[model samples]
Target: MIKKHLIYKKDKWNMLTVEVNGKTLILREISDQWGEECHTFLSRPAMMHWVEERFPKEQFEGSEEEWTAIMQAFKEV
Candidate 1:
């Protein structure tokens, strides 16, 4: 089975989707202006880098711990 979670959503133009299927995790950045982009991560570090690059902590809508928890969840998967 595949599960998808919306980790962050500021508006229609900016949102992040994390999709998990078995052992594969797919991160998708959905934007109306920039268009949709999909990234597949096989390692924790790569996933972290993509998160930091696409969604900076300073500009994130949630708390720092919330962001950390999101990453931690990814790490566990």
Candidate 2:
């Protein structure tokens, strides 16, 4: 089962936790932006980068289901 728990929502962004295989991974959603313009879906690269940069100490690697859950979490959050 996929479980989504909201961490927080501030301004135009929302942070959530998605559980997969009994482990929880962080996922975030924000108003999409491209180049010098704002658009519709959040950037996947940006989301991965944020997790890597801010939580460098974490040994994070995602499974296929985890990735799916992350995407769904962003959409539903």
Separately for all candidates shown, the number of backbone clashes (residues 3 or more apart, or on different chains) is 0, 0
- Candidate 2 per-residue lDDT, tens place, 1-77, comes to 55555533434533444333233344434433421222222454555566446334334354566655554554553
Reference-based lDDT, residue 32, model 1: 82
For model 1, the stretches where C-alpha displacement exceeds 4 angstroms are 58-77
User: Roughly what TM-score does model 1 have, to 2 decimal places?
Assistant: 0.63
Candidate 1 lDDT trough over 10 residues, lowest sum: 68-77
Assess every candidate by TM-score: 0.63, 0.27
Candidate 2 residue 8 Cα shift, in angstroms, is 1.9
Report lDDT (Cα) of residue 10, candidate 1.
76
Candidate 2 accuracy as lDDT: 0.43
Indicate the residue-level lDDT of 1 in model 1.
98
Q: Which residue pairs does candidate 1 place in steric collision?
A: none
